[model samples]
Target: MKKTLFDKVWDAHVVNSIENGPQILYIDKHLIHEVTSPQAFQELEERNIPVLRPNQIIATADHNTPTQDQHLPVKDLLSRNQLQKLSENCEKNGITLYELGHKYNGIVHVIAPELGFTQPGITIVCGDSHTSTHGAFGSIAFGIGTSQVAQVFASQCLLLTKPKSLRVTVNGTLKKGVLPKDVILYIISKIGTNAGTGYFCEYAGTVFENMSMEGRMTVCNMSIEMGARGGMIAPDETTFEYIKGKEFAPKGTEFDKKVAYWKTLPSDEDATFDKEYFFDADQIEPMITYGTNPGMGIKISETIPTLDDASFEKSLNYMGFKAGESLLAKPINYVFIGSCTNSRIEDFRIAADFIKGKQKAENVTAWLVPGSKQVEAQIVDEGLQTIFEAAGFELRQPGCSACLAMNDDKIPQNEYCVSTSNRNFEGRQGQGARTILASPLIAAATAIEGKIPDITKYYLN
Candidate 1:
């Protein structure tokens, strides 16, 4: 019987299986951040249970962290206390921590893969949903709740029923200006949010094969948006190359041995999936969300669809949009180009390349945020910071800025923001804030245009 990438990795980590019941799955990495971890730590402390695998746990402070003023004291008392508790918990548990202002500090999803903590054929878990981002390396990664966090802390294992396999294949050359973000938005728009429910999705075909590591990460990061348990891409040369020479990656012969194992982790040629879908890449375009959920997206050149449903009307009403109305030239006030989904160095490079000689519109307040401190350093090292500053884009420090309204950076009520983050749920960016999810290129273009433009001319060639 042929096996899939998910099956291979998941089977390897199974510690015990009950007859027709949940299996005990070993977790290779447990990532934690300030907000969700404090409760889990407190639960363990109250019960006098020690963290079983401190070595496997990595802690960071990101959610609710202020994007400005790294040196000064944190202003939000709650945020400051959470950060302090995270530090104390990690120290008590003997787990390694990358605190705020630390070089390795960043969004939990961002720092893991960049620092070589994420690798192929491993099971990773975090309290945050975007933890699925690590599945770009062919891992069985997903999010867990606070109780599940305590379970992992107690045993470094989870009792879970296996998810069915689903594969999405897209072949053919991607059109110009259609990015990885666009490809995912296009998929969600076609399949809707519930298509991947009760499934672990595997991305396949030449389109994913040809993507760089950064692009693959971007694609996998949004897997949760479609309601998939997680998402995966088979590890290949690109995956190995990205993991090599990182801070925590094995060196020399050790790395070669690891690669030898990784090469065998891809799905077998004759493997069968529970469900499969194929798409033509040429049909995809630079996409943007028009409604509350990610599935309500359209090509930049298209108008809103007329759907008859109370929920549909509710979404349109929240967005202040009408059926059959084109978003072209619709004025926008805020634009954000950062998140775990698209805040990699390549994303900034794309935005910098586009905005190099151009100035942002006077009416738009554009914020450019890196995903991690390392990415922040790369921005300065490569002089992308100068280009962004000269183009009138504010280059904010790294955090989950404007992606969610947990921190100071927010989109005002009823104002429109063209964002590169994953979700566009109503008020996701702030109270009553309307979000239009797009690729970094679209976000940058929106900042320059001060509105949603029919960027067909720029997108076509």
Candidate 2:
């Protein structure tokens, strides 16, 4: 029987299986964060369960951590208490933690991949929804609920019914200005949010194969938005190269041995998927979300789709956008350029390349937040910070700034913001704040022009 990459990784991690029922899957890594881990930790404490395999657990402070003033104490009481609680829980449980101000500190999804804690053929679980980001390296990674977090803490295994397999293939050359963010936004827009329900999606074909490891991560980061259990890409030389010298990666001979194993984790040529979708890369362009949901997307050059559904009308009403209207030149007052889906060095470099000598529009309040301390250092090292500063953009410390309204950085009510974060649901940035999801390039251009720009004009000249 030919096994798909998902089957290969998943089967290898199965600890036990009930005939015709759920399987007990061993979790190779358990990642925790301040927001969701507290309840789980309390649950474990209440039940008198010791954290099993503390070495397998990694904790970070994000989601609720302040993005600015790292040296000062956190100002938000709830955020401060949650972060403190997380630190206390980790200390008590003897789990490794990357707290705020720690050099390794970052969004749980971002830091793990950068440090090589996320690797091929592993089963990774986090309380956060974007845990699928680690699947870029051919891993079977997914998010779990609070009870599942406690379950993992107790036994490091999860009883789950196997998800059906799906494959999304995109062939041909991607047009200029199209980033992995745009590709995913385009996919969800085409397939709708419910298309991948009950399936593990494997991203295959030349477009994905040609993408950089960071790009692959961006693609997988939003898989959950499409209702997939998770998303994965096959391990290849690119995967090995990205993990080669990472902090937690295997050393020297061990790396070579690991790569040999990873090479065999790809789906067999004869493997079949339960469902498949094919797309032409040439048809994809820089994409942006128009309505409240991620599936309500349109090419930058196209007008919004006129639909006759009540939910669609409600979304349009909330966004203050009418059907058949183009987003070009729609005045925007805010721009956010960091999140787990982006916020890597490559994303900063791309923004800086466009922002080099240009100045931000007087009307735009732009914020460039790095995903991790390491990425922050890279921004300074590569002088990307200088370019952004010169353009009047504020560079903030690492955290999930404005991606959610948990921190100080926020988009004011009823204002428009072109953001690089994954979701654009109503009030995702702040109470009543409107979010327009786009690639870093689109976000950068929006800041430069103080509104949405004609994306077709970008990277074409």
Candidate 3:
């Protein structure tokens, strides 16, 4: 029987099926971090259970770790306790951990792929919504709650109901300055945040085929924002190329064998999806969210929508934005270009190349954080650090900096920030903070202009 890519992977992972309940799906890789695993570890301790497969689990400290002064102890009391507990739990359970100040440490999602721990035709689970980022390599990866994290640690398996498959295809050439981030923001706007409920999305089309691995990861990382269970792009030559020579990836003949299997993981020609959506890549412009929700987005050149719905009105009020107003030239106080969603080397390269020899607006404070230490090293090697310094931007230590309000990187209340991170919900960056989510290019241009500008004019010309 012809099967969609999701079916091919999910079915392969199903160890057994209950009569009228969920499937017992085997997880090949289980990732944990500070925020969610503490409770799970405590639960295991109460039950007097040892981690059934310690080697299969990998822990990292990112969510609550400070982006600066990593060598010193965490200043926040709660953050310090969480990191300490995570280290203790991992040590007691015999699991590998990438602690703070460790060279390999980074956001769980970022480090997993960079280390080649995320592979095609496998099942990966993490207590992080952005775990979907690993699906860029054609794997079945998704987030789980604390209980589910405990379940995986105890048995290396999860109970899950099969999700319906949705195929989203984007064909044609993307216009200049229309990045993968713009493509996803455009999709969420058209489909609404709740449209993909109970569905796992398979991204297919010429546009996705031509996208780089980092671009694919960016698209999949935002799958949860649109209510999808997860999103995936089938493994191809580009996927294999990215995995090759990575620390955990298969080598020599083993790699060749793995590639042979991965090559067959794409959806068959006769496979059908439960739902399908097609987009014209040419129509997608550089997108930014004007309202609180990620779905409340518009093209950079478009005006805010004047909807009669109360929710729309509430969003505009929260954002201090008026209907029918253009975002262009709206003054911004902060510009953040980092996160699991857009802090990869490719993202920094785009921003650095654009900001070279240009100075940031005096009124704007810009933060350029790499996603991982490896990415930070790459930046230094490529001389992007020099360009950033020349442009009046400072490179911060790697972590989930400014993506959330967890640490000292929080944006001040009511201050508008052009950020490349995911989500623009009310107070997502800090209490009462206003977030304008955009691509790295848009963020960099906004920093240069101290407001949202026509990025095409600033960079392309």
Candidate 4:
């Protein structure tokens, strides 16, 4: 029988079939973080249950930790307490925790992929919504609620109804300055945000085939934003190469065998899908959000859409944008480019390449945060930090900084920001702050121009 990648991984993890409903899927890797795990841990304590697989469960403190000096006390008492409680909970449960200041510590999504804990043909989960980021490695990863986290901890499995498969194929080559983030935003605009509801998205075709593993991660990381339960790209040579020599990947003969198995994880030629969507990659350019939702985006050279055909007018109006107005040359108060979405070393490399010999706009306040300690270390090793520093970009610690404004890196009130993180919901960057999510390349280019502008000139050469 022909099967899609989703089916291959889903069936492999299914331990039992329930009565015409959610199947009992075995979890191979569990990632926990401060914001979501504390409640789950408390629930487990209240029920008097011990974590069944402490070794498989990894914890990190990124959402609540200050990205500045780790030794300095957090200013917000609630955040400080959350971090402390996470440390205590992990210790009591005997779970391996990469705490603040640890080399491996970072955004849960970023740390897992860098450490090679996320792999093909496996089931992974986290308490946070961006757990979909792990699906980029060909794993069946998804986010779960606090109760689901407790269940996974106690049994390493959960009952889930298999999602139907939706194949999204993008053809043609990406244009200069266009990135994975732009491709994704363009797709969402084509098929609204809810197009993939209740489906597991299989991203295939020329665009994904030619994309680097990091690019693939960016695409899959935003799957949930389009209403997909998860998204995946089949394991290819690029995937195996990215996993090789990582901290947790298979080594030696085991690696060869694993690679062989991973090669078969893609959908068969005759496989059938519940739905399929096609896109032209070259049609996309650098995208920037003008409204509260990610789907409310336009090319950097275009004007914001009018309320005539747009459905989210109220939300868009609340975000301080009107229909058909050019976002170019608009005064931007803040610019950020560090999040799980675009904080990898390659991501920074792209940004640094654009601003290497230039300076950030004097009127703009920008923050450049690495996604993980490993990414931060790589930037330092490659001397990209020096270029960024010389160009007036502040290099901050690795965390989900400015993405959710949970940490110290936040946009000031009523200020407009060009950010590379996912989510532009009202106040997502900070209280009353407007967020315009774009690619890291776009974010960097805009930082130089101090507003939305065509970045082709910087990268065309």
lDDT per residue for candidate 3 within 389-438, as digits (tens), equals 99899799989989997888999999999999988988889999999999
Q: What does candidate 3 score in Cα RMSD to the true structure?
A: 1.0
Error of 2 at 372 (Å): 0.2
Taking the tens digit of each residue's C-alpha lDDT, what string does model 4 give over 1-461?
99899999999988999787788999999999888888888888998999999999888988867888877777889888998899899999999899888999988888898999889999999988778888888899899999999999899999888998999999998887788999998888778789889999989999999998889989999998899998999889999999999999999999999999999898899999999999887788888888888878888878876566545677766777777788888888789998888989889999999899999999889899898889999999999999999999889998898999987677888899999898998989889989999998888887888877656665542
Query: What TM-score quantifies how close candidate 4 is to the native fold?
Result: 0.97
Error of 1 at 346 (Å): 0.3
Give lDDT tens digits, candidate 2, residues 376-435: 999999998889999999999999999987888889999999999999988999999999
RMSD of each: 0.7, 0.8, 1.0, 1.4
Task: Assess every candidate by TM-score.
Answer: 0.99, 0.99, 0.99, 0.97
Better of 1 and 4 by TM-score: 1
Per-residue lDDT of 235-316 in model 1, one digit per residue for the tens? 9999999999998899999999999999999999999999888999999989999999999999999999998899999999
Q: Look at candidate 1 and tell me the lDDT of residue 358.
A: 94
What overall lDDT goes with each candidate model?
A: 0.94, 0.93, 0.92, 0.88
Error of 2 at 250 (Å): 0.4
Clash counts for the predictions, in order: 0, 0, 0, 2
Extract clashing residue pairs from model 3.
none
